[model samples]
Target chain A: MNNIKELLKEQIKFTDGYLDKYLAEKDNPQNIIYKAMRYSVFAGGKRLRPILMMNTCKMCGGDVNEVIPFACALEMIHTYSLIHDDLPAMDNDDLRRGMPTSHIKFGEATAILAGDALLNKAFEVVSQYNGNNPQRAIKAMNMLAVSSGTEGMIGGQIVDMESEGKDITLDELKYLHLNKTGAIIRSACTVGALMGGASDGEIKAVDEFAQNLGVAFQIQDDILDVTGDEKELGKPIGSDAEENKNTYVKLVGLEKSKELAKEYSEKAKKSLEMFGEKAEFLINLTDYLIDRKF
Target chain B: MNNIKELLKEQIKFTDGYLDKYLAEKDNPQNIIYKAMRYSVFAGGKRLRPILMMNTCKMCGGDVNEVIPFACALEMIHTYSLIHDDLPAMDNDDLRRGMPTSHIKFGEATAILAGDALLNKAFEVVSQYNGNNPQRAIKAMNMLAVSSGTEGMIGGQIVDMESEGKDITLDELKYLHLNKTGAIIRSACTVGALMGGASDGEIKAVDEFAQNLGVAFQIQDDILDVTGDEKELGKPIGSDAEENKNTYVKLVGLEKSKELAKEYSEKAKKSLEMFGEKAEFLINLTDYLIDRKF
Candidate 1:
């Protein structure tokens, strides 16, 4: 466990360095957008998505350098989504990661443009990839686009928005999380696998692992919302209940949500069995996720 | 002039057909987003960008089929920009092209998501390009991303947003319009030339033509906003004045703005001299843009 923690710390540091390089600020009139983008990107994210991608690539015996650009691009997409999600028109979140949201810090218009710029930058970065295998880079780019697009994250977001304050079935909740969080998480692993030259079966296995892990991660988030330290979580608890959101903890009791999270976590780990000792870190990461307090 | 108009009409039809096919709606719960995207896309505006792209490809002796996907994607990017520009937090416009804006038709959240989905769809469509020239396609894709990103459209938008209601200088207004309206227009031409397999010299000529034409088009827009008929323009005139926007007309008097538009139009045509008679269509198109009532 301690070894995994140390590895995660190092991975986060490495990912952040790449992110900073790719998203470096410019000295121009429109630098405000750059500042706004870097603000949200560097706002102390756990860098889970990029870390997952890099590790997946390494585990598949792929060159980390080839995967680095896509990993950073994925993180940028994730950051852009969060920035847009916290807009006044959407979630209206004022505080994220213990800091004022992008819109709150920089007026609504700049924040929106910053989100847009980041999304555009993601593709820009991927398109600039001059790897030996251009086809694989193109494939990874498409996966990132499709997963973050209407049929994936946006679809989940719309459903989640519509289902607010309504009684949604468990199936509906599952669909929501699967698209919203699951799609991007799945894309991270699959894109990394593709970059690493994984076969179809290996890609499928990683997809399954990511899908289950995404759901478990969301379930843990819901459970933490109900019973989490405000200081550790960096936001007030019960906000989900306050918003009347249809979270896992809301549909099921807290104890049941925890049990389901563990079940999904176990399933996630089970999907990685084919990788054997090579996937030990991912397996441990799954355990850490379900057991995380923050 | 009539021949040019006929060609424009046919090009718009062809482009719209491809766009409809690419953005076809699925019978699913999240189909609302598709509907919203199609709504704004099919809205009755001149498909100038796509038309320019297809024509540029044809003039360069490249296959129009290869450029069709990119043409559609460029239009999608343009549409998404309009959707975002009309948001309540931004321009707050209620009507566009004589119809309710996306945010007015659909709610704010859906409008934002629809914009995002369209942007993602642009990249998704481009990534699916299976032309023989994968390198050229990648180059075009990168051009699209950079031109529409912070260094291009978004950069222009931020500067425009910041300069609102401020007494800005002529150079500032030019910079704003160049980045805002100019980047995407220039991208349309340059990407087409690249995909059409134009030589570097030809691409350079097209870039210069587009840079001048973009400014001419924007200047003409400013002039129409003050002097043209509202029914012909499809929206109320004087909105720029009402918003205190730093338009070319506002910075330079109306007559000088018109002169500037004509001067830029002439320069645009001048740059196309290398193609001689083959560039007649684009030259006429330039005249049409500057002389447009809308």
Candidate 2:
């Protein structure tokens, strides 16, 4: 709804469609699982996470072009999660962005293998990155591992699955949302800071901003499930209610959840205060996360 | 058998559960997937593959302890594949080494998640080896990525699933088996060479040894399916035959499969000629892979 459209355009322009040319080499790099991996990775999404990462880097004095592979790597990890989460054994959703999900189009085995390949390749891409400092690469890689591994998003998923259709405390719900959604969001910011060679204090501020923003993002999703238009959301409205999922609105009232989301959005914006006027995009993004219909 | 057992003992001693204190802090690392991952990885097994790696590194003039993490990493990948392969949707097995399969012991969801965690953690372990020679670490990591990714083992898995109960050419069968079994086996040897600073000639020889040895290993399993005693094998004999799976003995006669195994065994031994007597452990390991009953 703002200047992000242009930024998104520039980022997605560089991200999509090029992978196939690389895959179409004389050696037939375009193998079946690679095709499946590439299909989901290149599938048309907003590329919001990568754009946020790149723009944040540029704002903090890093070359966005130099960080392109990492941006692609983040997209790869994000896409891998979507692929796995759509498996029959996992989230089991058949539709994504109005097209059949990866498992639905490719067989289940290929879908599983595609996720596996993407995850392995992500580290490969990051390893290829000879950043200005090796220690920073090590820290960034460690951040990614924790964010994606059992201790972070995966841990959150396990707890969420166990809590489904059951009463969960607000504390547990917050922990789940923070680890599940906030972990990656925070990781994207941390990656930007590392690439940009930010000071430790600046990195801490970014982490706080991301964490607050992530809560608002999930809270907005809860609001959307109850109020959003199906066509706009591209899925069933009230589906969360139907699933009996433990959510912000379910635990607290809808009014309270909305208030909480606003509180988080404000705190997110507050974390960007030190950047003065250069943090407009982040501030706007925080507001947009809680304000959007979907 | 005479010298190999002694070497196995020596190699195992080099690893010596020495990381117990550091890993203990991280061990049972507080999440279901983390706990399950440790259970699958650190739980007692033959340690045969890691031992092979250690001995090969020693034979090539590398520090055995320096390569220990890679040795552990290789086993993690192997364990992960085994765990996933036994899932209900995959091999659907219930027993491994006379114990419940990973999917049977943990629920399918946890089993799947556990495998996913281990695979991710394997790369995490490898990426941490940023020694003085970052280039060697990079080369080793890239080799690992290719060997483990879509173009290698997972591709084989996809083809193996698609071709189950279908007729296939011998070349196709070899391709499938080579990738499914041979890729990591080849990796085990090459990783050792990479650690040891082996010449290209040395690396090539070890690679040849690994490939032929891989064929022998798979052929031995095929032979064991029909001829091995159940007691020794710790499971039902003739299992592959009962599944109507395509195996070497099924395509060619039993005698020919045995002859092929012998030929491959000879080739493997000859590949080690450059290293002369120093490769005795690897030579013995090759013999053990082709000649063992279970």
Candidate 3:
């Protein structure tokens, strides 16, 4: 814990190895989509969701290896969502994490298919989980599926699309972010809780913790879009405003948005009071998430 | 049974009822994607995949009702694939089943989200199957996920995209169809067998039956594209040629393609000899599939 950055780096490296195992290079006839999918998945991210899941499971006294496949699946789903969000029909972003977007590298059609394949493969990987608790594995898979489906991520996406360039209520904006980003993040925690065999009370506590953290994470993102350096952020700032998308920073002034993020982060940290010192990593992670320069 | 057409109609009706039950209209915030999903699913192209699943389950002495949720999930996945395939960057077809394509009916972004939602929801539905055999349900769900994933349908699709306007060999064409159209259709049967508590041997036989039927089904589609009437087919005739796609008809002459379909159909029927008269409906369905004018 002396060097949180080093700890995060180690977690990412471990997750990358697991992901590489799941997405090994193939030379089959249909290797094009696999290659494209592997490209986006291996395109570096913080692996925040998966690291959180594995850490939460470990904190709950569950064997981390049992949840490794599921953690990898979560990362794949996140990567696929990013790939789809960058499509020409969606946000149409050309760059992600300082690299060409999936549609920018592969053609749009192949990119779309690659995203589809990754999403399908996420479920395939989770369904193959041979952990000691089959029931909990199914439950974790179910939570992940619902969190990323129409009622969750996709639902939020459609609303975001419909609300683009149009004025939306603060509640509407919150609803959009809650589904588009919050649901999957929340699912990451809940699935980990289930896999870790957490007590019902602990599971509920983690859910609340994850939900608040997820919303706070998005608010920090909004803040970063205004204050983040392009070199560090790896993408242009002010694109959200340019796109006329409603965000916390746009709805409230920067100062008020920062205050809101702090409040949510505090609430996220407070939700872990049930775990005492065992929640140190999660509590520190929330602060780092909010205070990061990028 | 008398009138295989009537039997097919009854099966479609049953599957439709089950689908409607699963896809109940919701007034939630993300209702837009749900509406788009329901529209494509109900657009109707003969509930062939779901029917094959249900029939396969019944033929193996399993209760059809036990696999209803999964059968509906199969249709949802099939409908989602069609929606994505009809996008502007893909086949760019405006009409499917005589109705405007999903992206035409809904905007492109919403259509894409709708397809993503459907795919996710398919897994959610199957994962919620509280049937008598939880282990089998997980296995069936895994099979469906894998079958429609990069190694299966999407794999076929990427190759199909790359092969466009290129002169591909007959073997290449078969590989594409075996994945693109063949995988899910085959999954419908394999999943059914797994759910129906079939023996390993029985499941293998049904898998072989489905593989043959899926290929034959695609060959019939090729034949229909070249020789069938648009009024009966719903979609335009010669559209495959219009797209410069390599099809069975394009590689082999129409007569040869038709003969190949017949050969596969006979093989499909022969594979079902293991089930004796219990597979009557499936056997008749194979003939109907090959002999279908629409």
Candidate 4:
């Protein structure tokens, strides 16, 4: 556990360094957008997605350098989504990662533009990949777009928004989480594997592992929201409940939700059996993510 | 002139067919998002960007089929920008092309998501391009992403938003319009030419042409906002003045703005002399776009 924690810390540091370089501020007049973009991006994110992608690439026998741009691009996409979700018209979140949201810090219009710019920048970064394998890059880019788009993240967001204050069925909830949170997570692993030249069988294994792990990760988030230290979580507890959000903890009992998260985590780990001892980092990651308090 | 108008009409028809096919709705849980996206996309747009791209591709001796996906993608990017620009937090316009704005019709959240989905879909469409020239497709895709990103459209938007109600300098106003409206227009021509297998010199010519035409189109829009008919424009005139927005007419007098538009249009048409008589449609387009009342 301690070794996993140390590895995670190093991954965060490495990811942040690459992200900073990719998103370095310009001296142009429209630099406010850059600032707002960087603000949300560097706001103490756990860097879980990028870390997952990089490790997955390494585990699949790919060079980390080749996947750096893609991992950073995914982080940018994630940050952009958070910025947009924090808008007053959406989740109305004023604080994210214990700092003022983009809209709060840079006015509504600039914040919106910043979010748009970040999303555009993500595609721009990936499109600039002039690597040896153009076809593979194109495939990864397509997957990222689809995962972050209407059929994936946005679709999940819409359903979640519509289902607010309503008693949604468990299937509906799963669908929401699967699209909203799960799709991008799955994309991170799959894109990494694809870019790493993983065989079809290996890609399938990572896809299944990512899908189950994504759901488990979200369930843990729900659990933490209900039973978490405010200081540790960096936001007030019960806010989801206050907003009448349909979370796993609310739909299923807390204990049942915990059991389900564990079940999913176990299933996630099972998917990595083909990799055996080579997937030690990923196995430990599954355990660490599921057992995380914050 | 009549011949040019006929060509323009045919282009619009052709572009719309492809757009409709590209954005065909699905029977899914997130169908509302699709509906909202299609609503704004089909809302009587002139399809100028796609028309320019396809024409440029044809004139450059590249098969129009090779550029069809890119042309449609540019149109989607244009539509998404309009959707976002019409949000309550941005321009706050109620009507676009005689129809209710996305936010006015679909609510703020869905409007934002629809805009995002469209942007993501544009990339997805382009990334799926599997022509014989994968490298060329990647180059076109990169150009599209960069042109629509912060250094282009969003950069222009930030400046425009910040200069609202302020006495911005003429250069500042020009920079704002050049970015906000010109980047994607230039991209339309350049990407089309590139995809059409145009040489470096030919690409340069189209780039210059599109840049000047974009600014001319924007200047004409400003002029029309002050002097054109509300019913013809499909929205209120003088809204820029009402909002104290900086425009070409506001920064320069009305006559000078018109002259500037003409001057830019002439420059735009001049750049196409390299293509000689084959560029008749584009030359006429420059004139028609600048002289448009709406």
- Model 1 per-residue lDDT tens digits across residues A1-294: 888889999998898898899888899889998899999999999988888898788778798889988899989999999999999899999999899999999989888889999999999999997657777778888999999998899888888888887899999999999998899999999998899888899999999999999999999999999899999999999999998889999898999998999999999999988888989888889898888999
Ranking, DockQ, top scorer first:
4, 1, 3, 2
Model 2 over residues A72-175: C-alpha lDDT tens digits?
Answer: 67777788878877888777899987788998998776787778778877776776756456656666766776787766777677777667788889998998
**Tens digits of lDDT, candidate 4, A1-294:** 999999999999999998898788889888888888888898999988899999889989998888988899889988888888989999998898789999999999888888888889999888888889888998999999999998899899888888878899999999999999999999999998998889999999999999999999999999999999999999999888888889999999899999999999999999999998879999999999998888
* Worst ten in a row by lDDT for model 4 chain A: A157-166
Candidate closer to the true structure by DockQ (higher is better), 1 or 3: 1
Q: What TM-score against the true chain A does chain A of each candidate get?
A: 0.98, 0.93, 0.98, 0.98
- Report the Cα lDDT for candidate 3: 0.88
lDDT tens per residue, model 3, B1-294: 359888888889998997887777779877877788899999876888889999899888889989888899988899889999999999888888878999999889888888888888898888876655677778888899989988888888888888888999999999999998899999999888878889999999999999999889999999999999989898788988987879889899899999999999999999989899999889988987888889
Docking class of 3: medium
Candidate 2 stretches greater than 4 Å from native? A17-30, A130-135, B9-30, B42-44
Model 3 residue B153 lDDT score: 88
The DockQ for candidate 1, computed on C-alphas, is: 0.81
Q: Residue pairs in steric clash, candidate 1?
A: none
> Candidate 1 vs candidate 2: which has greater lDDT?
1
Predicted complex 4: CAPRI docking category: high
Best by DockQ: 4
lDDT of each: 0.90, 0.77, 0.88, 0.90
lDDT of 4 by residue, B100-206 (tens): 99999999999988988889899989998776888778889989999998899999888888877789898888888788888999999999999888999999999
